[model samples]
Target: MRRDPEPLLNIKANAEAPADARPPGERDPYLTHLGERIRSLRATRGMSRKDLARGAGVSERYLANLETGTGNASVLLLRQVAGALDVPLPVVLAEVDGHADPAGQEGQGGHRAAEFSQLVQWLAQLPAGDLARVREAARHALSPSESRDARRRRIALIGLRGAGKSTLGRALAAAEDIPFIELNAAIEQEAGASLSEIHSLYGQAAYRRYEMRALERVLREHDTMVLATPGSLVSEPATFNLLLSRCYTVWVRTSPEEHMARVVAQGDMRPMEGNREAMTDLRRILQARTPLYSRADVSIDTSGQDADSSLRALRAQLPHAD
Candidate 1:
């Protein structure tokens, strides 16, 4: 049995594009599946292709091409897509990664793997000079660094908005005599406006760009610091992964009641002033982010704990903090 090509004729980049604009063809199944996954994730996030394209720093046409399965993307481009989509790269590469498994572990399309192994073995038998040249070439091909991938000296506090990340992060920094950074504040400084203003002028996609750049600058300039991140940062997997790669992230845990109370006590009544569903939405958001927050290297329950006690507990988890 053969299946006809799936034409994504209904998906348009903009209102100006024709509804029938999708080119018709039965493309590679792997590419098609990957494209479909990307499209589906975008839809779930309530983002248009243009938004994804902008966040990924790719052109709208390229994004359209990718979503249609006609594009043969490089590893770098795939990474950009993963970042924009806020997913691990492996998710986008799942089907192809399995069938094209480099380790031959999937039991399919492994001739190249076996041949490459043989080539490596044969090279091992060669002279020292030849081996050195081959090793350099392999290094070039690998282009991976353990040190760059190593977790950094920074400590990051992650959780919901009113989870006490800012307070605890600052205290931790003060105790250790390290600098403290609030990621959203850094973003706000870079944008020269409030987060709401930035979002109003440039959308979430642009705000994420600013966030990434600000974090990059912080990491580059500071050798060690305590960073308090935005609650929703977990939604951006790439940025979060980068944080995990370079920082000991801690989940600042607190109860919903405490969260709302703290936000209100801080005089930011925006959470419950006008919006009737604010508390429900906050609950939903916290529930949704719990799994992601759990990925942190450490956790400190700030609920029912004062500033000094919470800071002491957090510091206890950090090496050499005591």
Candidate 2:
């Protein structure tokens, strides 16, 4: 159900459209609520997507899109899905009245395979009015000072390496007169070596340690700055969640072909020299991370777009980009 290329995709005329057409975070209220209830109940049962799909007599992809607020399930289908979760149909229907958030509205666009975290499960359990109250309390808590400009707090650009996060982030920062931070560079500085050397000498575990420490300092030192983040950042769930919680994130996306070309143009010839399945591997990464990346506050598709074009799209998404 993922857009595959854009930040969000419109429902299509094809068979896959029902699940993919509606953006994950934006779906019909009743349907969205029902989907969350289904998802949450399914999680508590420790059932995998395949298991539930088989039991419900539905395709795995349909179940996935349904859980993400993307698929449109019929009353009969809901009954099947409810049965699969071993919950009564009436219970599922009534719980749909709960009106909990489907996902982050701020993160409008898009990774994960279709799994709900414990946090999502807890959030879904709140009553209708309690959801709003909790959000209000969170707003007050997160923005401790009333006068602080939320727009100017922090804007992080996340995407595949060739998705133009670096290029667009630098331009946006220049236009906004804010600092531009490259997280990878900071990590290298902290480790006293290049990223390759750090990975080769100390391994990924050490590199992640340096990454988290560098990320903390940047968030602390700069109140307002545009940053280009590593695509692999989503692999570190804790840090990725922390990044989403603290900053207004944007997923900058482009086609896999474009990503490979851009990376090659930037002098990284490993894709061309090393792996024959480079494009396939890149596509797999994009697909696997879509759920995690969907946590971003917004998105901008840089595919076939020039610097000025992409910048304009980004600026429209974030006012501070100006």
Candidate 3:
């Protein structure tokens, strides 16, 4: 026999209850339950509300309300929140249904979309050459203005290696008629050392000092320019936050397989030549950095797409980039 799907329940507080019947500052039980579940999952993952909001692409205020039993989060929002908490969607829905134990319900957790969210979380952690692509995506998400107005809006692209920040950035700049600058090149010129040499001789901390100086110089000198930045900029939270505060940010992304293919096609075998466990390391690095990347204004998936297509797609989305 074909069984009907579960009905969506409307949860509301009783209007007929006596004034004192409800505790002070108490909300509807269902809302309170949802809030508790969100808080529980967040605590279990060792994430603060801010961390959860960033990971889920929602605002911290919204998350706070959801946890405080005051906000009526939609189904889609609940799913995103659940995914960010790394819990199964049904686990959240089950709580809503008054079933604390999901294991007791048959096929309750069989939602493939929830499983797909897990896969996305796993893939989001993988690293490859697509970090630059994410930067380009961020840039493309912003508005492109002509005339002097273009000079007023500041933008920055930050992501991982091989994410195509430079390549796509130039195209975006040309389309918008704005100047394009390679942040790494600017850093090398300012420090008088190549990135590899800086990393090898002075270490990451030294390189970051040079990178920050270069970023400040560019931000001060050029009011309007498409900036191509290194992916590791995100590792320095203070610096990255400063850059983000000064400009609109974008994140370009792609699948691990696509990232590997692009790097191989570019004749860059550094990742492959290193440890055999490079892919695993890449995944861990991306996972650690994804929260930073999610802070961008826009995200684009550049997998299997050409530069023109990616740029055009990004331009369409960018209000000022038009």
Candidate 4:
């Protein structure tokens, strides 16, 4: 069954509730866990509270209040803290279980939790190649047979921004008489907020959660559609794997120069604003992500080509192109 958007909305709603709403002496488990998680992550990074406060753009006094579980932080503050901690927002928000219980004071639930932790530790030590094999094995072992039989007509285009994904995706879908969906737009609709607002309010982790849910809903609802995903969608392994397994994946390739040119042509100049090394940074990012993007089933370079020309080339690369 498709889960409703209420759960994600509830996270924000619950987080933003006034601290006074609780009894004067009662501690919020959620806030307590969040505070401890932040402190632990900062300690692991060998940072002081002052350091974290500066990084997060908050005052030390406010941070201290949060760590002591005496402050009610706004979502924006938490987002900044998550960014400063160099971890996803979900990690910061994750409840810290088993800490209150002493060693050997565990019930059946605790025992099972320990076993799960041990399994994760064991898996973490495996070689990269072995890990991939283990993942595939586990996936096949657990997945329903029907899930393995995905429709080939469901196409997904993945690449960096300005690679002509949106442009070519619409053309291809129109040519084939199919629905076209932009994954980011779907996420925004699901969240009831813009992408920037999502990041500003809930951080990247929340955005990622919404992204996954939106994708799942789309897949469940549409058996055959063209999905134009966000540029960084490839960075999330689970989401990308689901995409690869279910869709005819395509990497819309273009030269770095052309990528910049297209973005400029679109009148969004934020890429080159105030950064002399913008092109260099873009190249570095592209290089780092190439291996991941290369996992697509097909690739098409649209450099130096008009949208019509690119559309024709992309269409030819699709399955059963006439």
Residue-pair clashes per prediction, in order, are: 0, 12, 18, 0
Alpha carbon lDDT of each predicted model: 0.71, 0.71, 0.67, 0.75
Candidate 2 global lDDT: 0.71
Q: Best to worst by TM-score, what's the order?
A: 4, 1, 2, 3
Residue pairs clashing in model 1 are none
Higher lDDT: candidate 1 or 3? 1
| Cα deviation of 195, candidate 2, in Å | 0.3
Candidate 1: segments with Cα more than 4 A from true spot:
1-152, 269-273
RMSD of 1: 13.5
lDDT of 1 at 58: 94
- Tell me the alpha-carbon RMSD of every candidate: 13.5, 15.5, 18.9, 13.8
Candidate 4, residues 47-127, lDDT tens digits: the string is 345545865889999998787776654653565566677555655554435343456577666665556666665776799
Best by lDDT: 4
lDDT tens digits by residue: candidate 3, 10-110: 22321233322347576766577788777655443324455458667799999988988876534545555576787766556542223224566435344
- Candidate whose TM-score is highest: 4
Off by over 4 Å in 4: 1-103, 107-128, 138-149, 269-272
lDDT of 1 by residue, 180-212 (tens): 999988999888989868866787878888888
